[model samples]
Target chain A: MSANKSILVCRCAERGLVDTDGIAGGESVLVIPDLCRAVADGDPMLGGAFSEVHACHPRAVQSLFRFAGHPLPDTTQVIDCRCDGAGHAALGTMEDKPPAWYPVIDYDRCSSCGQCLEFCLFGVYEKAPDGRIRVVNPDQCKNNCPACARICPEAAIIFPKSVEVPINGAEIDDEAAVRANIRVNVDEILGDDVYAALRARKQKRKALLNRKKIERALEERRKCSGGDQ
Target chain B: MKMEKTGVHGIPSTLQERDSLRLRVETYADQQGLVPPLSMEELRDHALELAPSSVSVDYVMVLLNNAVWRETVASIPYERRLLLLPQCLRDFKNCPAEMDEFGLLCEECGRCNIGELQSLAEDLGYVVLVAEGSTVVTRLLDGGKVDAVIGVSCLNALEKSFPHMADGAIPGLAIPLNAGGCIDTTTDVEHVRNAIRLRSDASWVNQVDTARIREMVEGWFSAIEIDSMDTRTEQIAYEWVCGEGKRWRPYLLACTYDALSGADGIFPEKVRRLALAVECFHKASLIHDDIEDDDEVRYNAPTLHCQYGIPVALNAGDFLVGEGYRLIASVPSRTADLMRIAVENHRMLCVGQGEELRGLVDTPPFTAAQLIEIFRRKTAPAFGAALRLGALAAGGDDRLDAALRRFSESLGIAYQIHDDLEEYRSGEEHDLRASILLALANDQRPLEWYAPDSPNLDHVFREMMVEEKAAQLLEHYKNEAIRALNPLASAPLKSLLRRTTSKMLTPAGGRA
Candidate 1:
């Protein structure tokens, strides 16, 4: 049954790293590390593995398939899932997780107008069981879709600064060895004094970052203690 | 007067007509010493005086555009010049390129002259756009990034953009596309190159023939000469060094030294050694880089590691690097200062490379800014070192040293960004290892497109946007490099450095 279903390949879902969640249950979703590599290798068996393959970037997929030595199967579909909310259901997840931006209502300035609820098409808002409008599905709120915020007549809505989500589980391989190689290579090409100067600049940057971190922590502590009063 | 010289679309267009018009304009300028910022009425009168009865209004408009802009274009800095090319210049059938909001993303496959023109203009620090009509011209004018324009388009599009240029008071020279079907059109390539190199000091054009410098540098690595030292390693090193490459680094070194000393002849002996040393270092880096990246080919030949095996290649690379240092040490003038520059830049280069390698294991979603920072660190230092070595060889003072460092850093980053754009256009491979396009795509595109296992995306709009941003950044850095030259008192050296900045971006055979 899963083999008969269409599998959507959303490339931007995880910064082109990996998206295991797109493999829903037993659905025949194949996650290739790189389309160019897959097409270059041209595994003939791939042509018949799935009923349909929908990709966010169809042109690239088509080019890759062509490069792979065969035309994309008739069942292949390319969708415009960039930011227009198309083919999102098949992809099974939104691109930006932990949603970098969401609407926040200011109760003090609010006149309790329901304009935001009407304007939002993504079901990001709902009438609560208690009959008051509230943010029920914040995850459904598209990243940087500020239409609802703009349409708010009361001007009570605000979006916080977008947080830069660090890539998870990413680690530099043998940082010290890499650095040592760099030093050795540089010393060989330039000379020892150049290495010393580079080191000094690096140390200065590190010290500045450390100082900033300490200052931020101290400010946070001060705010926390001040709020206690 | 019959309109005998008409185009396919009945527009009065012919090569002879255009040439005669250009000849008259040049004659007028020569006779009258007419610089740009001329009134439209004055330009019209001049055109009428040249060809009162036969020339069409379109030809007059073009002549006017040239007359009103030539001197202004010459005076404006190269970084402030924009080359507006029409999409029709592209090979319609063979081009696997796409259009963005700003313009066409040229693949630069050399299928058409657009690639050559774009490459040349960009090398000269000109912002090149492959789009027709007035839209981008108006935007570029309003943005204030471009001070002058050299546009190639049909008469229709040129007329459309004329009002916008006039209103903005922007100096512009328009070269009408040779054909008028708006697809697969051609332009006089020689004329375009001449306009691009039209600076106030025409004598500066081809002042340092890079080909000559390359030939001279090649002699330094002669196998016979190197083998005379009686060592197998020296022979191998010489062979590796003498292999086919652009030799841009050595050229930069020699150019800088010449600019500083105001010497118009072959580099003196010490400067030659210094220039050769710069190449040795660059070639050595390539060898080790190939091994690290596991690349098989370079300059269309087997990489050092691939040819000689990793151990021997590594040793050879190390030996070349040592030779670079030795060469610098052997320079007669201010060897200590030269060594300092070489060592410092080498370290910076390593740190930059280390940062890049470190990124591989975790493969962080680097932003464009971060990638630019890496470019600055890794690529800029080599250029800086080459420039400083040349400067020091010419007996440059501390002030020049500081200026060269700043200038090279900016030039280096801009150069790398330009390379990234070129690589993206070539579509040879989808290697986004250190690509600014990928960084911008990651930062701007929706989350779903960021998946590690995702297919290569061809979002033309995003690519164009990123390219626009990168061009702005490139312009910013180019200006910074120019600014760094402000401290220098010597006018020739200043002009030479400016010309060098232009030369650095240009590929071989880019100039006329």
Candidate 2:
């Protein structure tokens, strides 16, 4: 069934932002282990199989589907269960492996280019014996640093929790989206030194940002004031 | 159903992917003959084929649209472009900015990326707006306040705003926030920085440094005496030429010429003659005005008539007038036109002074309309001639000439009022000059109040609202001057005129 045809609930097994205990369970209601993780992991249950979503927030849940390559139809209503008397969700199962915050490869888009493997400073990816690149240490990936993903040649890497779309797994839909999102060519700015460049970006953003205003003001004063005279 | 896959929603995930996709999209757009403003459908088809299957049509469409518009957007002067940023980009938890009807008033606190981006765009001359939604965008575009936009928003919001861009085909580039929740949204800040820095090969954007131009014009007057300061009259004329006046008339002439000249912005030698002629006409009028008004002080020195007596001062003034004609007649091009301007302006000025000398034997010492007419006739012609001569040298078109005429008229009247307000404080005695306040006072005062020592002078002036009326006229004329420049197409000349207005009338903020 398409997502719009049934009600969906995420009994978030861990964070418990929502609880499914009192929800009416019927053919019209569909329950999920966790929408965020299900979307992140490419779980088949997230397919167009529900009409309504009982999630933390409509916008957050809607984005979760976008990351999973299946956007929620406009016809579906997302019911927020994060507040009110919605008690802590109990999934009645053991907590699985700690939530992964690593890059997920979109195999359909990956051209086996090995760009990610070469770009990773940490052992996030490795050359499999079959001569294919694989995520060897997903846990080792840096948190909130999607630098490696930005350097992807085919935009095939997904950081499900990232702040920007495409990287966060939302589809690019319009010119505005395209203009806002640019895959930067690291070679152009830092001379192909991805490792050093990535490391320096953090520090430089601070250092360079400090001087930008001062430099611009001096330049503007000269231009506007018509020079020292 | 096909095997489930996470993360292949179509936008570029990695910078490398994005970079490569952009190049491919450019090539594809060219091959497909896809012009900019290729509607969403056209972009979709090409995007699907050109971008990686994993990437969405919208991702590739950005490349395609930018490929076509990149040159156009870059070519627009930064002064004409608008930078539209969403307020949600702020760190709502820590942001201290306030929102007005127009948009967020950024505090530049550095708590969020908006501050850095705003500073960068503003430095390049963009009008920046940090707001939510497309309302401000529509208003700005409709009002012709901007030519292009660099906008950032979330996908959900983009859905609403993108239609405006696509429909108008208004040249713009958009960046969507990575995840959607109005709070704590993120984007590639570096990407934004690059977009703001984009420029075209227009050489003039970097030209016309105001101070450099001011210094150059000042240098021209400082460098010479009239071949021979042989006679006493010659010496006085040269001395008056180098007096402590601001040299604004000549500066206006040179700046106008520069604005309309070649992109290299060279100050041609011939312009010196034309500028000096302008100064001559100005000095000659000041000399004669001092004789008529019997002024004792000018440029912080004794009036020419006071120092040299009316006989010699009158002769010296005639000599400067002759010199003005001589200088204009010497310039090779537009000699006839320049001479006509000088003579016509000189005539209007004499007529205005003639009215002043005849006396305001009317109901109020002088009617406000009659005073304004006197100011317009006396002050506006000199400024008009200066600007017109400069423009004529540039081979300016009829529209430019008309604009210059309108601009100079308002500028002249406004400037005269400013001077009057400065010289005549409220409740002060009216000098021999035609003062707006005197006219205003006459409008309210009883005939007996005209007595020299009328005790209620200050009270009558206050009750009449003389100061406020004069200030309003000054402000009204200043705005009129600005409005006159709107019809002008030359960006440099418009900018120069605007800067000139600000320099003169900004103090007319006559809180007086």
Candidate 3:
């Protein structure tokens, strides 16, 4: 848990994965946004969703590098420009493959509800305090850009087709430009509606709050049930 | 009886018999497991004590004449009707007068109200439509999908809908707009909550199917908890007042939604679950009532305290309250909010208990008006909430919620008065004998009754008969009950309810 220890280690704990390689004495360890991909690409015990993410993790994480997976995740899937401030960023061309890193965003349409945050396991966007979303570390994104735009209540958030916006008045790589336009995380951009729904649903379930505690006991009972076998 | 180890497939069949036998044996606990049925006089005496007035007696008889209400309910296939009350109109907050204005007529503001109603429609759960006007109603019903309706409206919409509501042979309950025409108005919040509760019925057929209840009770005998002291307490509680009670509160809700949607047949799971919950509440209240009254017998069996100790019995009631609510809250999250209201209503029951207790000696000279207020606070909320929650569970229109509130309030007062008259006549005390009605009624009579109790007060019983003036005092209270019901708009259900109310309005000697 040292400052020098990568955040990936922290995220690994959050995602319920057991970390066997405990920062062994001064060994050089490459940082990657996702262990799911690192495990799936080279290691065993993961498949399907990983097969899809192996293609898109690298290009988005411009600052940090992930050695385990492919070069970059399809940035086209992480569409909202607000997440990346200066619109679509380019990461050169993967010729004969239609440059899988097309960036998309439609700002006027987004109601900014953070269902995408819950949907994304890869911590692609970080929610800011002022109710806007920012994508500070896109390198953590593991290809399956689910947090980008799957289901929005108001149909407010959407992916913009690969369009290029000028960043710093220079036409850079579309994935890079997309990366530079990092104003907020998708959740902060669409925070209110999800917050309201969560609040309402919570209030209604208040009487059963004790049941939640009971559920812990029930869980213990369930575990014991397996032990009985 | 030899315990049979039935196979899994055969478990359900035997479970039913087992539960039925369990109920029976529990009833006969005092007879050492040979409970003889109460004689006709015993039933009449109990019935009369419970329902002395003509109205109450008739209501009981109607319930007793199970053939009638059941046939009436059965013949009417479940139907649903939806009256999109003004609350559905998002802009309903705009105008002061245009809201669910205690008057009928709704100004549709075009919002999520219609969307919610549409989803209900698509579920094929019921026959539902946005009722913007009276003319549209006929066409809506002409499709013949709805047998009843849950309406949302001010008094104005109700005025327009009532004729169509009646024209369609539909049983409908209105969910009125909150106090102001607004959906989120503070005054309307409780009104909306109550109305939804009243309109929603446990739809016993839908969720907690008979198959499941049988399943849960299955293997229960062999289960670890069956013979425990707690189980015995529940058994004793269930034995008393376990016969022929219509889950009117829960069913009213299911019926309201079905009426609007033109759905047929009660969802077996819904009503079964609702019945379980409602009956638990009813049982819990009775346990406490018996404790307060100091009665030892009910339904011709020893009361909870008589069978189990008082402390255990009280805990048993609380356990049921908790269990009943959990059963309700355990439902899907979609209807979780409605279940929460069911739990909150238990607080209102406590309020009624407190009022009843405080009234025992607080000689504030009870008036008919005051008693009516007490009954409204104590009883109407439960009855009204029962019907509303069912409709809400089905996601009925917000408009009819208000109208249903008024309807339940009226019906509740009528029932309370009928109860007072019955108690006045039966003079049968099982427990909690320091009756509020008895005391209040006696208060209104001439002081001469307080004079040395003539022949009636002789013997050790003379002190008990000190309140002979109760019969005369009940007469005035009955009028107050009628007045309470006068405000709501008319419909067949209202008339039936009124008839049920009047049936219990007889003189102490079965003479109307």
The best candidate by lDDT is 2
- What value does the lDDT take at residue B271 in candidate 3? 46
Compared with the true structure, what per-residue lDDT tens digits does model 1 show for residues B231-252? Answer: 8888788788887877777777
Instruction: Supply the DockQ value of model 2.
Output: 0.01
The DockQ of each candidate is: 0.01, 0.01, 0.00
> Global CA lDDT of candidate 3, please?
0.41
* Highest-scoring model, TM-score: 2
Q: What is the lDDT ranking, best to worst?
A: 2, 1, 3
Which digits, one per residue and each the tens of the lDDT, describe model 2 over residues A4-42?
368888776644646565786677787776676676567
Candidate 3 residue runs with Cα over 4 Å from true position: A1-229, B1-261, B333-336, B425-512
Q: What lDDT tens digits, residue by residue, belong to model 2 across residues B1-512?
A: 01112232456667687668677766776676544444455556666677666766665666676775566578778876777788767876677665533446676889899989987987777767775434434434432223577877655555555544543445677765655444566777887888889887854342345567778878887887656667777888878887778888888888888877843446776688888888988898888989887789998889888988999888888998899888888888877877877788889988987887775443336767778888888888878988888888888877888888888889989998888887665334455236777676766653422554556656776788888988898988977887787666565566567656756754433221
The estimated TM-scores of all candidates read 0.43, 0.49, 0.33
DockQ of candidate 1, scored on C-alphas against the true complex (2 decimals)? 0.01
lDDT of each: 0.63, 0.68, 0.41
Give the higher-DockQ candidate: 1 or 3: 1
Interface RMSD of each: 21.7, 21.0, 26.1
